[model samples]
Target: MRSLTEQDIRSSFVNCSKGEAKRLAIPRDLDERPWADLDFLGWRDPGAPDRSYLVTERAGRLVGIALRFPSSQRGFLHRSMCSLCLTTHPGNGVSLMTARKAGAAGREGNSVGIYMCTDLACPLYIRGKKVPEAGGRFEETLTTEQQLARMTDNLSAFLDKLHA
Candidate 1:
């Protein structure tokens, strides 16, 4: 997998809204599939066990991934980890995600799926990003770069398994 910058990722998303590509949380499965055609790229947010996230990937690299966890409860699903950040949320934060094979991914099976942070805040994690956990803002310990690297490493492993 190749290393990437913020722009390299946001540019591939046709659905970018404001600066949401960084905070809105998109999916890692890049190729487009009709909603009904998609098998594992999305999951019901545990909080709102009915809503799902939108997962996608960046162009020009196998490293960048995103997810859009829905905030509304209107569906059903199982528990899973977000392929990008590797942070597991309860049923509320976890969601199902997947993508199709094409381009360099054609032989990689028709699709790949993963669970993700329902809010899709991986950008912060990718670009030296992080938010204070719970009420521990002033006592936060992990550095931004540390957070980014951990996320990158975890995401890479997740995608690699999919390739295998």
Candidate 2:
């Protein structure tokens, strides 16, 4: 992923109105993001914990989506997995993030949801830069490259649904 500016992110949104995009919070650490390690940029709004955002370069263009999720903390004993990166976490570490569909469907309140990292840090988790305290265990035989490809594919599919 490449570093994106506030303007770039605001303009990349496909599911929200221009005015809404302009008003939503953009990450304050854009310049400090590790772009080389990212497949997409995602963050929850500090002002509104239930609100989140994701942006990525797809099919030669930047695409972004606004998301919503439960703000309440989860029980510590349960485990959940991120649909994109497949990293398992204590229940509190995952949330059901939902994105409104692009265009008309979104305007009508239709949305799609999936379990994802609560902090939207799938890239770091997958790259081993951030480790879960519980330690993730994968029984699959795929190599790291294959796992990464799968993650990309899953995200693409999610984006496709948003665009559908």
Candidate 3:
């Protein structure tokens, strides 16, 4: 992934109005992000707890989506897996995030949802750069590269659905 500027992010949004994207919070540490290690940029809105965002390069252009989810905490004892990176976490660490579809469908109130890491750190989790509190343990034959590719593919598929 390439490092993105605030303007780049604001303009990349596909699921929200330009005005809304302009008003949403952009991460302050854009320059400090681990771009080389990222498949997409994901972050929760600091000012709006129920809102989140994701940005990724699709084809030759950047595409972004705005997501909404409940702020309530889930019980820590239950285990759940992130649909993106396949990392297991305590139930509280995952959430159902929904993104309004792009264009006309979005204006008509259509949206898509998926279970993802609450913190949206799938890239780091798969690379072993970050570990969840529940400690995901997987006995898999796939290498890190393979896992990362799968994550990217999964995310792209989700983005495609939003466009569809």
Candidate with top TM-score is: 3
Q: Rate the local accuracy (lDDT) of all candidates.
A: 0.43, 0.88, 0.91
Alpha carbon lDDT of residue 63, candidate 1?
A: 33
Candidate 1: stretches off by over 4 Å: 1-83, 86-88, 104-109, 125-142, 159-164
TM-score of 2: 0.95
Give all TM-scores, in the order shown: 0.39, 0.95, 0.97
Candidate 2, residues 1-164, lDDT tens digits: the string is 98899999999999899999999999889999999999899998999979999998998999999999987887789899889888888867888989999989998999999888888888888788888758484657887677778888988999899978
lDDT per residue as tens, model 1, 1-164: 22233455555432223354455433343443232322123333354433444333424332333333334453234334456555544445545555443234534335555665665556543332445132112223667556556665665555565445
The residue-by-residue lDDT of candidate 3 on 89-151, one tens digit each, is 996788889999999999999999988998999999988899888659486799999999999
Task: Report, for all candidates in order, the number of backbone clashes.
Answer: 27, 0, 0
TM-score order of candidates, best first?
Answer: 3, 2, 1
> What lDDT score goes with residue 72 in model 3?
87
Give the TM-score comparing model 1 with the true structure, all chains together: 0.39
TM-score of 3: 0.97
